[model samples]
Target: MAVVFDKPTLLQRIAPIFQGFDGPLVFAILLLACAGLMTMYSVGFDHGSRFASHGRNMMLAAGVLFVVSQVPPQRLMALAVPMYVVGVALLLAVFLFGIQKKGAQRWLNVGVVIQPSELMKVAMPLMLAWWFQRREGQLKPLDFVVAGLLLAIPAALILKQPDLGTTLLVVASGLAVIFFAGLSWKLIIPPVLLGMVGVVTLIAMEPQWCAPDVDWRVLHEYQRQRVCTLLDPFKDPLGKGFHIIQGMIAIGSGGVWGKGFMQGTQTHLEFIPERTTDFIFAAFSEEFGLVGTLALMAAFLFLLIRGLIIAMEAPTLFSRLVAAAMTANFFVYAFVNMGMVSGILPVVGVPLPFISYGGTAMVTLGVCLGILMSVAKSKRLMQS
Candidate 1:
């Protein structure tokens, strides 16, 4: 017998890539993406071509998502360590000789300027899931300690950059992996308890500690001011509290039905700062009102639930962890942004996922959706 090589035909080559696609996940994401486009059109039309830019970014992101879905989870697992290493290295580079803008040194000009902290959102989960998969059946307490250490190093560097938003995101993504990996309750309970108590203690001591003369050693001045402002926005109504105060007003003005598209007074009058980025949700609420807000929330909630269900059905431990963490990342992005805008939580600059106007953040989310689609498709491809 003679050996012969045959290239796959067009249909043969492409069919498997589209096989086992998760319909509900795809549908939910599309729904959210459409809503995002519509919302951006109304909120960002006057912001120097933001609507056009956002649409372009989203189309690019969707393409990335489609490309990523074609990659198998095993290959993704192999790439995990390299991605994590490169991401951490970039973070170090940023800390050393990075671009400085408006009091934060967060972007690196490595040929092209990029934010390294954004990479950690996906890299952290991929790395940790790979770590756990390697330790599979016989995992012990020491392994989790190592995982925490792995998580801590990059998180600490981002924190030093003083990007509270990215730091929160990185830590939350890592913690979701750790939590899903079955770490002991004893270890989990203490920190959570301490966090709760710390929140209470801070509230109690707000009057004394929030004073201008009081220098909190751990937190940067702006971070402290944000906390104080959260405690009592009225204290600096015209200054630090302005964003939140205006946000609340916009959200409240929506009532049962929104004021109608682009009819938001607060947004049109320029009372809302950063209306297309972190504060876009406020503009959304003002325009869409309570009904529109709830509908958006419901879409997000559906996506969250669907992602978790995929995690539950994942074929491998790595897939499960990655899917679950990515889902939580989406949840956190929405919750934190909404909380900060609505005056429930201190502002941390986290954007609303899939909705906020930023290229890097949109790319991160696109890759995340790719990974999730990969995970969901992995099992069905194998069984077929």
Candidate 2:
């Protein structure tokens, strides 16, 4: 004989899967993801596949976030060292016999092409956070020295691949961990002062230094040209400066209000380079204008603040460090992308978080948000 039973309600069935999610964080991510989907639809108005592909990527990212958020912070720390070691080892593999693409040796091909540098974006923070957590009570200058060494190795390897944007990102992520771990003010001051002085010096000496014939030994010629281009984009209006000029036009022409969705002349006319990736902000600005730009900026600012709050309230040193690094990474992603697209900084292939169309980056972002959610949920559990 069989017994008949009533089926569980939908919420009862779904509740266990989302058992520990931080509601606000998940909602914030969903909002951004929705905006990304809408923008991608407009970006690929004529090509339905591009928009559909972006939707698929977002779904993939949402899956990653859900799966990853289920893992608690302590267990995350347990996997940190091994993940970091594998990441660095893969970077070495890329250095030794990497696949070359578009003149950069940043990919390691096993069964498929993968950018090992992307691994460091997450791994570096994990490694540093774990390192600091281990030395929580007895931290010293030497520990930071060792941390710097850990950061330098993979960063140098990626730099040799000639991917400056990713190198900067990895370095920044590691430094965020260190900074949150209470590295001295003295350690921070010199770099800030020197950077200010360097900028002043560059501006003052631009006439002779930015000359085409001069060889800049410190940076690759193309990198040096990007700096020069930022200093004065008009110097090569239709050449090195073309991207910046077009981006600026799209942004400025948007004026106080904007041209409305799918109505950006510069975007549709094909003047804005990489309109769906690096320069997506320009197209966005052209359509949404200042009001929409402010709204978007506010959303990012809220995310940043929310992530930092989670970091500050995390129960352990490792969680704090990881959370802070992840939060700072978001700021860098938003600031650098906006700066370059607005012509205030040189173009670096950094995508605008959810707004940019790319699979690997979206997955990485999903992992980041998932980790933050895990940390936040852990705090709620502790309180209960």
Candidate 3:
């Protein structure tokens, strides 16, 4: 017998590969990936490790996006419950046996100092969406209560960890899911009213509440200082106020056209804290100026719009909720970081998405993008 080699048919190989996909989503991913690489290159110009690490992270994120796009919506739905349960369990474990860093216990050492709170940022929405999907087209008041209970537990635990930024993100993610799942305006009114009332009361009672002698049982001292610092950065401009004051100065100094990349006086002089991390936005703004800032905002806006469209077109309820929540989460992250840098909000140390340099945050964002891509692609697959 003569030896023979067989060649595979093109359809046989390509058909299964594109079972689900959204062209717009792939375009968005490529565009953001380029932006991320460009910013990382600028930030890590001399630091080979940072550049190489981000490159690896981008590859890992792309792999995640590819794998998630292949998984069916039903399978993702099935994963929601167990992932949430495990996440909650890990959070509880953090309270009992966790790593204590700078007086906060937010990480667990299971051969790695894993932050359970980060998991909730993604899982909380998935869990809530799964719950809402279970009672689809037949929502009730009790459902909202159950959803609140689901949100409150992990949020409370994370707050106890004193990681306020992550706690807020996780809460916002879960709330977004519930809001999209047909949560009544009637139910939303009370929380909105109460929140407004609470802010008023806090402001009116600021003297007594913020007195150095009187301690607020709820917030840590540092947390309280941060909120107060935001109110009047001039109060302690050299101490707790250093971050906001420096950030505002850097942003203000960057006129319309900016000071040019890596040539920013404040950034080069190291006046801005965490320039490569949480406050990277200020550094970027100082260097790139108004034009670059607006361009970045445009990309984020496009992402949010496409994300909303994908959520609306999602084939399943779980997919829709997850997509919406993830989209909202991204917006919140950007809004909070920018606000903090501009001295509009307290310094809670939230990193600027794609621009800031942090492995964990970058990885988390990549995973979020992957999930969204999965939802969008699945919808496309179903329609075709």
Q: Number of backbone collisions per candidate, in order? A: 0, 0, 0
lDDT of 1 by residue, 1-384 (tens): 999999889999888768899999999999999988888898887777988999899989989999998888999999999999999999999999999899999999878889999989999999999999999999999999999999999999999998999999888999999999998899889988999999999899989989889999999999999999999999988999999999999999989898999899999899999988899999999999999999999999999999999999999999999999999999999999999999999999999987889998998899999999999999777787
Best by TM-score: 2
TM-score of 3: 0.93
Clashing pairs for predicted structure model 3, backbone only: none
Q: Which candidate would rank higher by lDDT, 1 or 3?
A: 1
Better of 1 and 2 by TM-score: 2
Answer with 2 or 3, whichever has the higher TM-score: 2
Instruction: List candidate 1 segments past 4 Å from native.
Output: 1-15
Runs in model 3 with CA error above 4 Å?
A: 1-6, 9-19, 46-48, 200-208
**Best-first order by TM-score:** 2, 1, 3
Scored by lDDT, the top model is 1
TM-score of each: 0.95, 0.96, 0.93
Clashing pairs in 2: none
What is the C-alpha lDDT profile of model 2 across 53-160, one tens digit per residue? 888888898888888888999999998999999999999999999998888899988999899899899999999999999999999899999999999998999899
lDDT for each residue of candidate 3 in 233-280, tens digit (9 for 90 to 100): 887899989999999998888878888877788876879887777787
